[model samples]
Target: MSTMDKGTGATMRQTAKARRRQAILDHAKRLFAASGFRAVSIEEIGAGAGISGPAVYRHFGSKEDILAELLVGISEYLHAGGAEIAGIGGGSEGAGGSEDAGASVGVGESAGVGAEAREGDPAGVLRRLVDFHLAFALGEPELIRIQDRDLSALPAEARSSLRRLQRQYVSLWVAALRRHAPGLSEEAATVTIHAVFGMVNSTPYVVRRIDTAVVAERLRTAALATLGVADVVAYRK
Candidate 1:
């Protein structure tokens, strides 16, 4: 048998260790979402991922490790994705990176213009961030649920680190919103951002009643209105 190493977190590695470890993480997420993190056991996680029982420990020390990786993985993924979206080097540092997260990837007004040009308009910037976040909300509902409910189950330092990244993400939106609406005080912008997040995060509940498309549109319009951006309007045919 090939020796098992936990391997670094890179999912693209061509080693079986990397592949099986990723499989464990994937299954863990599905199981954790279906059954709370506390209810699910490592043995079950192994079974779900097609790993033989008792072998799951080789890749992860304990269930808490898996949960920690899951939380950090998503945060880093968002930071990486936000960096990619904003046209920064992958090695770029910080939760928001040097460039704006609202910027689009492979998109620019001209070569070398980068995120600065991509995010030229304030409303456009807010729209891009809203669109990115909404996509995150709609596509990863389970992860969202886990983030909302299971976050506290992790250790305090880990949880605080994850939250600091989240605050940085929020600050990008607040800055962009304030830029678009210069009249808004920092406190007002912060409050509005929280209010819109409250509305957007109620997706699992609100989406049950209306078509997701409809709810998304309403949320987008309402978000712009909350920021007091001019020209906010309903979807026009």
Candidate 2:
């Protein structure tokens, strides 16, 4: 094959591999959410993903590896997303802003705030964080359920890494909250952030019963309220 054709073929294979890996993760997440992690086997996950049990090993080392990737991958995603929303760089807590940070953190920009104001405004940041989290909670309730019940199923090193990433994500909220409420203590901010997370993460149970849009709005209002912000109406869709 020509060089260009060879490159195209390699890219296609990589894309297919990624899709298969994601399918396995998706199936494993749902199964683990329904049944406990220890109760779910690789054979079941592979079957759910429409592959033979041994085919799973081509994507992951074992069942525990799949669980580790699911949990750690989401944690990393959250950490990176929080950093982006907060206009910070990489995994560090340093001061830097993304080029599109304003757009990313403007979930409530409809309130007539300019991009400049939305970029690092504490209220805008908090509102944006709420909206960002609501998207994940509503769309991936299976991951939330799995994390809630099966986090301990991960190996010790993976669990520690997940917790560290989680702490960093929480710190973003704490920073934003303290910026909005100057008098708030670090302990208070951390506690309030966790409370909002618990409330938002509870969507897996109620999503089937209520309209997702309504559930999102209500959670947004309650989350802002928990942060002592009174202007949820401005952020309403």
State each model's CA lDDT, in order. 0.65, 0.75
lDDT of 1 by residue, 173-221 (tens): 6777777788888898988888877877776454756687887777777
Instruction: Quickly count the clashes in candidate 2.
Output: 0
Model 2 Cα shift for residue 173 (angstroms): 0.7
The ten-residue window of minimal lDDT in model 2 covers 102-111
CA RMSD (A), model 2: 5.5
Best by TM-score: 2
lDDT of 2 by residue, 94-138 (tens): 212222221222221111222423465888778777877777677
Query: TM-score for every candidate vs. truth?
Result: 0.74, 0.84
Candidate 1 displacement at residue 161 in angstroms: 1.5
- What TM-score should be assigned to candidate 1? 0.74
Largest lDDT belongs to which candidate? 2
Stretches of candidate 1 off by over 4 Å are: 1-15, 80-119, 205-210, 230-236
